[model samples]
Target chain A: MIGTLILVVCCLLSTERLIIHAPRPGRLRTPDLITLRSDQRFAQLKAVLPTTGVLGYVEAPGTVNAAHYYLAQYALAPLVVDYSPQHALVVGNFFADSPPDLSPNLLLIKDFGDGVLLLANKDVR
Target chain B: MAVALAAFLCFASGFALVSLFSSGTVPDASAVLFNLTLSAGFGLGIFSLAFFLARIFAISNIIAVDAAVLVCLIAALLLARNASASTNLLMFSPGADEQWPRWLRRILVAATSLALCGALYAAIMQALAHPQGGGWDAFAIWNLHARFLFLAGSHWRDGFSSLIPWSHPDYPLLVPAAIANFWTFIGHDDPHVPAAVGLLLTFAAVGLLFSSLSMLRGRVAAMLASLTLLATPFFIEQGTWQYADIPLAFFFLATIALLAVSDEQSLARGSSSSGFLALAGITAGFAGWTKNEGVLFVCGIILARQIVFLRAGRKRSEINPSFHRHSSAFLLGCAPVILLIIYCKHRLAPPGDLFTSPASMLHRLLEPFRFEIVVKAFLRRFFSFGGWLGIPGTVLLLAFYFIVGRGQRRGLPAGHRASILALFLTFIGYFCVYLITPYDLFWHLRFSLDRLFLQLWPSTVFLFFLLITPQKLPLSSNVSR
Candidate 1:
């Protein structure tokens, strides 16, 4: 009886270990505006992003006016804009129209999509 | 109505028989009735004892305490009458004249008293710590209904309105309504009061069951069973939580005891045993009213009893007549509770969605299978040791298996065999019900399966101890073996 109990305890402890060591499924990666569409470019850009901060994305059909207003309202993260000829100069406009209350950490990077661009925290790689 | 009348008559008759046969001293019919009433009063006294203590400690409201006390008193009285009938029937067995040793009797009584104390202490301590809702069912269903009743007030009927979509409108309201009536008298609609009262009733049922089973069996069985139940992690935890599982378990055990008595009487000739059969039916009916799974238990017991009767009647001529008569009496006694449940479900509350919409019910039933949910649930419920029985029960079960053989051994009498069979059937019934449950079986099993087993813990332990305990030792033996 003592031997059997010991065996049972050993088996249970092993099962507990297996449960703890099981691999978890990966989460979906949030899109970054400044990263290029190529897998390698996106990977490189992802590495430079803040490890702890959230990645915000905006997708709307209308003009950039509404998107700009939403970005201003929720200004915690920099806007990610799709790489496009029209959005190339929008980085300058973002820097010019930046709210005085905006943290100095907000840094406008390059665009990734048609009109999408990436913003980064100044401390990020 | 017929069922209620039959149950009342059976109880009345059992009281008379107990009065007649008690210690070979027959009291008058009036005196018997008075004693029966007194026993009921005693039951109420026990309830009041617990309630008053709860109130004194500010653990429960006076109104909730009073209602719980009253219900418990009534249930205890009914159960005690049943127990007396059971004891008398056991005494009529051929070898019953071989009186129990005086020391053994004293040990039995002391052990039973201690078990009752332990169950009471555990329940009270749990309730004091978590007064409002200790069990999950109490929060998810029973107390939720109480909350609705209190909040809805004049529109309390609205509480059962199917418009809510989430609440089970068709569920019976006997328990919640009783609490609502207390709230009405106090002119204060406090949901906590009803929830607390429900917890008190749950504990009272556990106490009475443990005490009664102990008295019927022996002290050792009683102690083991009570300890198994009180120490069961889930049951003890829920004893503090407000849930209907404990109450349902109480009613389930009451029905099992009733059936056991009836079965015993079936074997004995010239014995007046119709009362217990009816009482068992009534208890089963109440069980059905308590919860949906209770209806399954009622079905299981009825089917098992019918099967037993048929088999017995085929072999013996004398068994035929009593089987028919007793079966009818059982059905007659069960009629009121059944009707009450039907009325509450169909007329008072909304129609059952599970059956009415076949498509929906089928969808729900098949969903568990699709996700490997039932397998997961079964494994979890079967292997988990955190229930009312806790570590002690696991140890006892392990010891029981090692000490007692696993397969068929033929030393036990027919009566003992039948009792064990009935217990096994009841356990299987609970298991099968969970396997097919439409709700989240995992959550349901986690919260309830253990406590449900605790309902039969006492009876199982009693049977176990009786079987495993050494009958006699050689006079010349040096060691205690």
Candidate 2:
């Protein structure tokens, strides 16, 4: 009797999770947004970036967190994405409409037109 | 399409290899499922090893390497066709089907099939919703490493550079290398490859649980146990998240299952089943390759087997003559992967972060507050970790087991006892690691304790079910000892 009861409960709970987590029409979850948005954002930059080297990264301050940084890293893998602005080439992940305040040592090298900016670091030889 | 073909090839390679050791040429339904489940895991593991070696040797044509591997496995399979049918892998007893009423068996089977379909739907929906994977670890660690290996060409070793310390460069490369291997065959990286691998491993775990129970207990017990696993929402969630936890859990369960089967075959044949033990060792090695926690499990299993054998030897007045043979076979099977792991840690990757200094570790281990925190968290998560609705599934199941009472069998089967001991030792290892973790105690426990519990949950379920002899069934008298 106990075994039967547990099986019933399991069936009910599994059904509940199935119903709750099933993808609905026109619904985009955050993970989906991360993959789609990040891939589209970095598609062109990936072509210009060296296939294998460490590059400095700066994001719009407080506008994003580790998720965006990880997505950027994911989209441009084989190239190490460091979270500091100390390398010869740095990536500027700022909103296209809201341009980021740059330090004097950083110069815009190319704007890949999706808030994906390549900046040259004058501090490095 | 390329991903599908790669998976099929993996399945084929694994099946052929496992067939080399299995006893039965003509298998029953349950045995077929058991063989196929092991085949999936073994196939992926072997392919990953082959791919890693190919990379190490600077072989660019991975497709050719895989094809050659498949062809060699096929050749071995053909050559070994007439070897032996002396040992049965299924371990089913006489009159196993008659132990439960036909109607009850039908109900359990139907319910289990229905629940399986529902779980599959949920897993698919979850995978579709997160094509990049279900968690940050997937993209940041597992898939990110795959991208490195797939894209770096001659410089694949750069993926393990210290510049990306957060990526856990010291971790073993089974998942990453497996995904990258498939991508190399396809000639492009697709998110589908990892997603498919994750789903296959997840379901293979379910299938293993079901078949192993069916072989050991009866169909009724098997279905009920599998239902509990499928019912656990987080098991499915973690699996679709594409983290290594599911793969880790799969191998843990596989090792345990293989050990149990080996013991059963040894008892039935009146000789040591070294073949099964060798397979167990391989699975345990694969566990080590899956995650660092897996290395702990490998140690735990070794220690547990030693203690179990020692106790048994004490009762018998001398150690069993087969112990040395069994140990040697297991170590032989485990050697290649262990060597690979050694090379990976020493040559390719940076030092792991956990055991930086003994003094600091001992200092952390001595803190009473840390122990208290870890103990409380472990106790709390043990019941609630599966994220089941209302009453937690594990607690409920334990309560039911007590209520039903252990049947006439005086003790658990020796294999079951050994597996339980291994799991307990592994649990203790987890506790100790928690006591000495360098990260903030509360934060680390909050994030990882659940996954740690999850890694052992399937094997725990199998062992628990193995102990419960169903007395309420109509043919209880006929149930095997």
Candidate 3:
């Protein structure tokens, strides 16, 4: 019994050691950040966000161009953005849009190059 | 003929080296050589088998078994020299019994040979009946890359045309590129090589799983697991179709083997268990390299390992060093393929209309809770076994579950429980992903659920046998006698 147990242990130990010592093939190292095209930026943003977070970005041409829908499905956060700078179009799903309308504490942040971003807390206006 | 000769040499050399060094006090030079040779045989045997079968069946335009054989040889040398103790589960079996009945002892050897022959035959038939364009995903994604590699030549790197962000580009090119390289060598582009290669690898995955389980648990458990996977309707179907699921299954089985080794080592003093843990990490990383779903699987494993470690009451300081090392090793193994996937999505492929913008996330979050769709899709995937051999297998799964749940088997190890938990978590993760998908959930479920189930089938069946099979089974007696 002890012999069988020792054999099993040795085999397991040796295999494990082999895996750790083995040189990994085809491993790539990338910088923390890479510059993305406007559309690619949107894809990156969608890829990074949590499933429940809402993303509200304007859909104007050359502004916030959404590219990969499948990637965005996992990025299912609500987005409320003004597509055209001329129009204050607060477009988003019911939950995100409703919270701003219902609360006095919410405030619209300054417009970035593409569109206005929103900031809100229940305690602050 | 040369290809067959090369494969024979690889196997013979590997077996001889293993036999030569298996009993030595220090497993340094000979052990390393044995591992390298065996891995080479394992990889090349599968690769050549795919190509040889493809050529015989006339499914592919290209025929360069020699190139694949060469690649296998190179890979073997590389793996042997750079080999780690962690991934050595390939060699981790109970000591062989020379005194056992020849018939009983030879069953696995025979089964393995038969399975390889069957895979080779299937590859030939698949090659002969090769489709003009690529099959669905082959044409849509995997083969498209192969097409670009062959046609674009030096500019093949420029073929990252798909805008599907999630459909990773820079993924490992070991399988697909190997196929394309063969095609290039033979002066003809043939996607069937890779497709068939995928099938043969799946067979290897099944074979390894069977052989390992048979050695560790018992013959019955191993046979059940292997036969169940082979007979799985969806598994067999997907084996024919060139998909990433089988490879992922291979990685999954690899992870289980590593864990099993680690567990066995834990019970024995002077054993190095961390090495298996590290190998498990590497295999898990490869699983991620195979597909986007693999990333989620990695997350699941990390979480599972954390849970197991904490439950074992290992101190944070002691555990942290080992955990960090394993994680780094895993990342080192996985990083290249992951980077390629990222590069493909960000730089190469055209962006699609899927969730590219922040607003898309909102739309998708609500999509899964579409009650009617979720229920219908779940039901279809869970119950529908019409085309595949799922009906009988599903019945067996249920029976196994029920029988095992009754606690017929005693002394189940903690590692076994952890693995079962990990499997459950994986199933839930996949299930939730399907639920949340923005597309036609029902159709997606019908298409993929069975294949998804195949990923866990081998492990599940093995666990089932472990629980239900009587301790005094006849096989054990036969072996002892």
Candidate 4:
């Protein structure tokens, strides 16, 4: 009897949580913009990048966490996006419109716009 | 349409495989539900294996391969169907004793159906809200791997390069390969594919729990057990997150259920068919293919079976060679997937993150602080893991279990004993993994501890129901072994 009561209580609690956590109808209508922007931001870069191989990645400094790095990696899969600028070819991602502060050994190869820059490691070759 | 077709193919393939192996003494309706639930996971696993091997062999046209495999499975299924009529396998009688009153059972059934509707609503809403799937892991890990497998073409091997360690290139490819296989059929990566897969697995897990319980326990017990799972809000949320944990949990639950049924059949007829054990092995192997933790599960279950096998042998004062045969059948089922995992580890994927130098690992293991922290975290998480609204679910279940007594009259059946022991061992393995974790102990636990628990949650619930009931519910009415 107590077991059944507990099951009843659990069911009620779950229903409550379900209602609380359910997304609003309006919210589902919009495209997931952050995901879209992330995918689109790297679209051109992906086209130019080699089909396979490791490439160095640099993002805006404070945003050096796994989230942004993994997002970029997600956008450019099959191409290993190493979270470092030591490779011969580096992909520079900056949030601001201006040029990112690059290390002296890194040379700008091309700016594909949208804060996505290609850099060549002068120290490599 | 492509997603639907792929899903149908997977379900069909799994149904055929399940029908080929499983026959029962349970009623036809219950058997269909049980077999269908198992088919969902099995089909997905089959696709994962087939797609992975095709990629390994550079067979880019996965559609043809899938279709071919489907044809072969159906043919074999037909043969098995004909052969089943002539076979004599042990079947257990369903326990009709102590059934709940009709009115109460109807109330419970009505309550369960309502809860199911609510869960379905929440899951669909969750999927709609995040059409791209949930959280960072959805995009970063599982989906990213799928994109690699689907888009990288012949160069898919590049995704496993050591250069990108954060994406967990070492992780198994069940989710990714299955998603990629569907994408290949669709001619593009539809984000809905993963979402659909996630939703399919989540409900399949629920369905498997309900159907298995219905067979093993009475309808009332089945409804109550399933209600507990459905009430766990976080489980529904996590399932929509498009992660591999739910799939892992499904396989875990499936393995235990199969073993329990197989053991019951053996006890009834004084013998066993290799079919059920073989199917259990396949599920265990797929568990390994689903996640790294699943590999640990495979080990834990094997150790569990060995312990049980030896005990039963000793009790009989002679080792039953049928135990050896069962074990071999299990191994035979596991062999194909295990070999694939070994190949992936040795030849394709980067080294996993958990292990480090033996000296460093040992030193970490010796740290008293780490042990204290992990224990406290586990204890806290144990009570709160499901993100219940009030009076956390686990605590309530425990309270109920104790108040009603442990149902210790028969002690645990041998299969349940092995399964419970396996889960306990798996928990120990998780604790040990935390002790020697290479990452920040806090971060690792924060990110993964709840998920790890969730992986075992469904099985734990099923086992709990089985224990509390303590009756030998009929597994099947006319079920084949």
Candidate 5:
């Protein structure tokens, strides 16, 4: 009787947890919006982005989504992600509500909304 | 269409290699499932090997890889076509030995089915929640490395540059290589691929536990064991999290399953063939190839087995159960992957972050504080690691064995006991790593301890079920392909 109860309780609780998080089966065909949005957000900027060299990535130091740096790097691979905002072309992921203060020499080339900004460093070597 | 053909070729190559190495020729559900799982792993091995060679030769196209894989597949299939019939055939008959009441059996089955349904839902939900995976390590490390491999073409080496030390490029490439192989076939990276792979490994681990145990133990034991694994919330989540932990768990379970079968065969036959032991060794070697921790498991398992034999005080003898023969056969199986791992560590990859600076490591090891933290963490996670929902699964499982007490034999064979001791040894090995780690000790433990426990959890369940199982085997059951 105790064995049955243990199994029953475990089965029910695990199932409940899964059901709460389970997405509609239909939505599976739709790839994650993270990738989709990243692609859409970077679609036009890809042309101006360097075809063969390292791309720079800069973000506010303590934002929750430091992951956007890696995702942007992933979506636009073949280009190295240099986290230091030292390169001529740097991806400024201002994931917070407002953009971060930066060197005046750096100019905003594109704003892919929702705080995804592309900044070009004017002080290029 | 081309991708379909490539996948088929990959499966064929793996299937052929497994069929060749397999001890049991009879095609039972468990045997077929185990063989298919092995094939998938071996197929990935073939792809990684060819891709690694392709890089050295400055060749990085789909056509070159497809041709090589096809040739290898066909050759392996043809050469091993006439391999002899299995000396032992394993069949699944739920109540072959003793009879449980019909209502009891039905209840057990219903409970197992519900647990399985729960597991499936969790895995699906996880995949849907983050098609790219939810954890920091997924996108940041594994998938990121795969992007480097697939998108960077010949310049894949750029990913291992010393600049991005956080990526841990020195880590073995099994998970990344498998994902990259699938992407190369499809012609572009897909976020769904990792999700799918994660789910596959997750379910595959359960399948492996069920099938192997059912054949070796019985249906009741198998169901309860698999249910324990399936009901673990973290196991399901980590499976879809696109981390190496689940994959490493699969390989660990495979090693234990193979070794258990080999031990069973040796007990049954006066002299067992080395086929199963060889396969166990190979699986152990694959474990080493999967993660750095796997290398420790391989060594720990072997060391534990030797220690058991040494303590037994057996005289040296030329016989079927001779410790020397079995150990040597196991080593023979591990040789190929061991070589590949050595080459990868010495030649292709960057220095591993852990244990890189000996002076600092020595300093850290000498510090008495590190040992206290790790021990406390180990004990904390030990009770909590099952990832159960309401109550911890481990607590319930312990209640299970205690209530089910002595209804059947629960003691283990010498070999199975060695496997259990090896697991404990591996835990000790993990402790040693925690002691010497270069990273901030708490941070490393916070992120990784649960997973390290998870890697051994399934195998622990397998062992627990093995002991509690009724050990009477019925001879000459009808076989099904």
Candidate 6:
């Protein structure tokens, strides 16, 4: 019985080492974000986004923007978060390093700088 | 400090509730632990109740939580003054029965302390590392829902909107509601609150494990049982993560613990209102309030108890009179929470992930290949859960059982046996869920089977230690076993 317990203790100490120190500069523990804070790019728009109602959401076509859409939705919750730019107003999130080129119909509503763009949907019903 | 004080108020209210509904069979042990475990369990139940009321009245705020909890505390304090505590556990306590060598006792005590402090430290550091959450589910589902409830004001229902189908809006709201209530009390959202809730439940589960065993089984059994649970890596991590599984597990173990306490109290008095059974049923019902699987546990425990009662009937029909009373007491405690859950499912939430169509479920059930995959995955995950360093805790428990022998001590009571059966039935319910899942069988099993296994892991250790332990164990005289 003592041997068994000693073994259990040893296992606990060793396994905990990997768990505690696994996340390093070059090593990613898992793909999920470590924190839920919004980027400063959204600092302006997040405050100005409509307080309620469906908010159409659009972002640059890439894996990173898709992830950002999730973040934007989280930031602007209680409002209906949709992936298409079909609502009366749409949030145009673009990469801070490379902003998206505009289409003909997405009229600029506001540019909450650092890559956060808001557009009024001309094609809205 | 404010969070700690609020938690204390919550614990006081829970202790008062326990006193009101108690059978006076509380065992002699660490008063702090006993109070903390019961308080955490009772606190969650009360918080959920208050949150539910707030939603109904559109008044979920710090004032509402403070008003509700303070009222409960005051009323309980006034009423519980007349309540009595039991000393029957004194007979089984250390030094009262068998005196172990001081050296051996020290070793056991040290081991318990080490496991606890180590787990607590690791859990805090892990939570500190992930300020957002421990995993994807925290921010995506639980905390996200809390954000809606906390920040959206009257529009909190938007968190349950169908637009976010993957968020499992249909899931019960105990963890989120409790967190949101805490956030509301502090007047804003803070990641520390969820991290702390996780901490409270994790250690509370530990406290329950240790205190319950010490009361019923003996001090050694309590220490060993708690040590095993504390040693589990995943239980600690999941407890730190802002997830519902650990909350569900807490309620699950509370149900089993309360049943044992009720049984012990009833036997002591010869016949009494099994208020503990009622509380156990309520805890199980609140389990449903924690997650979808908890609903299954509520039904499973009730059915398991009934089956055991009926089985006991053929041998002793005279006990049938008390059986009905106990059953009714349980239902009375459980029905209100079950009603709340039913309301949530029907009124506030969307459909669940599984069984979207009766036809698809029927098709899935008949496929032998899916069955094989799920069964295989269950077998594999069962052995490696909680990131255990070596053999899984379950396997270690089984080995211990084999070594100790499976004989039911002649002194073991019927009610205790009944509770064990209910736990087994809950496991069976989990197995059946795997068989009829709507998702790809292997993928579903691999991703979730470990966590699902963890839900029962603590209870399994508790029951295993309870059964294998002698009806009367003598303290070891030797320093080394």
Q: Which of candidates 2 and 6 reaches a greater DockQ?
A: 2
The CAPRI classification for model 4 reads as medium
In order, the B-chain TM-scores come to: 0.67, 0.94, 0.69, 0.95, 0.91, 0.91
How much is the lDDT of residue B9 in candidate 6? 63
Q: Per-residue lDDT tens digits of candidate 6, residues B340-378? A: 889888888887888588887887778898778777777
lDDT of 5 by residue, B1-481 (tens): 8567666766776666666566346756767777777677666656656666666577867556757776865676556554554444444344542555567667778877987887787677668867878776887688888888877777887777655537777877777877787788888887877887788778888888987887887766777788788878888888888898888898888888888887776665545567667777877887887789999999988898888767653532322456678888889988888888898788778888887999988888889999999999998887787656667777776777787745755445667878999999998988988999988899999989999999999999998888877664634443323
- Highest DockQ: give the candidate number: 4
Q: Residue-wise lDDT of candidate 3 within B1-481, one digit each (tens)?
A: 5335434444543343223222221243323432342243234333433432343344443334444544555566456545432222223223324323556446544543444444345433443344321234544355545544554433444444332333345443334544554555546554445655566555666666665455455554555456555544345445655666666776777676656545544432223324456446656655665656666677776677668656654543323334445545545544654564455457655653333555654565566456566566656655654133224455545655564435555665556666777887887887766655656766767666777777776666666654554332112211110
Better of 4 and 5 by lDDT: 4
TM-score of the first chain alone, every candidate: 0.23, 0.81, 0.23, 0.87, 0.65, 0.72
The list of candidate 3 runs beyond 4 A from truth reads: A1-125, B1-127, B130-134, B163-174, B273-275, B314-355, B367-372, B385-390, B404-407, B466-481
lDDT of each: 0.46, 0.81, 0.47, 0.83, 0.75, 0.72
RMSD over all Cα atoms, model 6: 4.9
lDDT of 2 by residue, B1-481 (tens): 7767787788888888787766443456777898999999999998898888999999988877888889998887667655643444434553655756778777777777877887888888888878778778988899988888889988889889877647888888899999999998788888888898899999999999998877766777788779888878888888888899999999999999888767765654455557778888999999999999998899888888887887776654333458768978778877789889988888888888888889999999999999999999988997786877777777867676766644424555455677899999999999999899899999989888899999999999887777775322222211121
Comparing 1 and 4 on lDDT, the stronger one = 4
TM-score of 5: 0.89
Question: What is the Å distance of residue B288 in model 3 from its true position?
Answer: 2.0
Q: List candidate 6 stretches off by more than 4 Å.
A: A1-33, A39-41, A64-67, A102-105, B1-5, B23-27, B60-62, B80-103, B317-321, B405-412, B472-481
Tell how far residue B451 is off in model 3, in angstroms.
Answer: 3.0
lDDT of 6 at B19: 57
DockQ of model 4 vs. true complex: 0.64
**Fraction of the native A-B contacts that model 5 recovers:** 0.47
User: Which candidate should be chosen as best, given TM-score against the real structure?
Assistant: 4
- Cα lDDT of model 5 by residue, A100-120, tens digit: 886687789878777777888
Task: Check candidate 2 and list the clashing pairs.
Answer: none
Model 1 CAPRI rating: incorrect
Over A94-117, each residue of candidate 4 has an lDDT whose tens digit, in order, gives: 878898678899899999888888
